[model samples]
Target: MKNVEIYIKSTCSFCVKAKNLLKQNNIKFKEIFVENSTANLSKMIKRSKKTTVPQIFINKVHIGGYEDLIIFLKKNI
Candidate 1:
């Protein structure tokens, strides 16, 4: 089982696309919403070193953004 976590801004299209992909694959992920709060956004940036929505992690390992997630899924799934 993959312990997946994704940090997302509520209105980002990339975030929605990333989530759809995860759902399509039946990969249950914990979504950390950062759109409505600055603190959550900062935490995501600190954790992933990226100031972008859809920052993804699997098994506590940082996996970058939506495009990166596609690569990861292609190689691993």
Candidate 2:
């Protein structure tokens, strides 16, 4: 498996769902929490060009948010 990274905000339901999905698929991911730090959130926006939690990446390539992750999983997982 490729390196999976997920940027998540605390208390975000979509983030939980996304992590759950990954776990169900037995995918190990690095969880980046951006709920308390501005720098992390800013980095997420800079990388994804979107101000949203649960921003996912695979091997340094942007895989987008929750629904996008689902699609990617369906096609490639």
Candidate 3:
């Protein structure tokens, strides 16, 4: 498995769902809460160019949000 990171806001249902999916699949991930930190949010935006809640990355490549992650899992997992 590749190194995975997910940029998320705490209150976002999509973020929760995404994390849950990763957990269910036994995929370890590093999660950063964008709501609690400005620097991380800034980095997320710089990297993804989006203000969405759950910006996911796999192996340093942006994989988009929850739905995209699901699709990626279907193909990779």
Candidate 4:
């Protein structure tokens, strides 16, 4: 199983969707909330090269946001 990490904001619909999909698939993940802290947001941008909610990583590989995650899951699963 791949180690998963997701950066999210609580109110983001895409973030909710991404988490739900992970749960449905039984994929355990670490959730990093970037809602309030500038430092956490900066970290996500530095890692993902994206300033979007639901930035995801699998085993330290950048898998992009929610749409990209779906594509990756489809291919891998």
Best-fitting candidate, scored by lDDT = 3
- Name the regions of candidate 1 deviating beyond 4 angstroms: none
* TM-score list, all predictions: 0.93, 0.95, 0.95, 0.95
**Candidate 4 backbone collisions, by pair:** none
> Model 4: per-residue lDDT, tens digit, 1-77?
47899999999999999999999999999999999989999999999889989999999999998899889989999
RMSD, model 3, all Cα superposed? Answer: 0.7
User: CA RMSD for every model?
Assistant: 1.0, 0.7, 0.7, 0.8
Better of 3 and 4 by lDDT: 3
Candidate with better lDDT, 1 vs 4: 4
TM-score of 1: 0.93
Write candidate 1's Cα lDDT for 33-58 as tens digits: 99888998899989998898899999
Q: Please identify which of the two predictions, 1 or 2, would achieve the higher lDDT against the true structure.
A: 2
Taken over the whole model, the C-alpha lDDT of each candidate is: 0.92, 0.93, 0.94, 0.93
Give model 2 RMSD, 1 decimal: 0.7
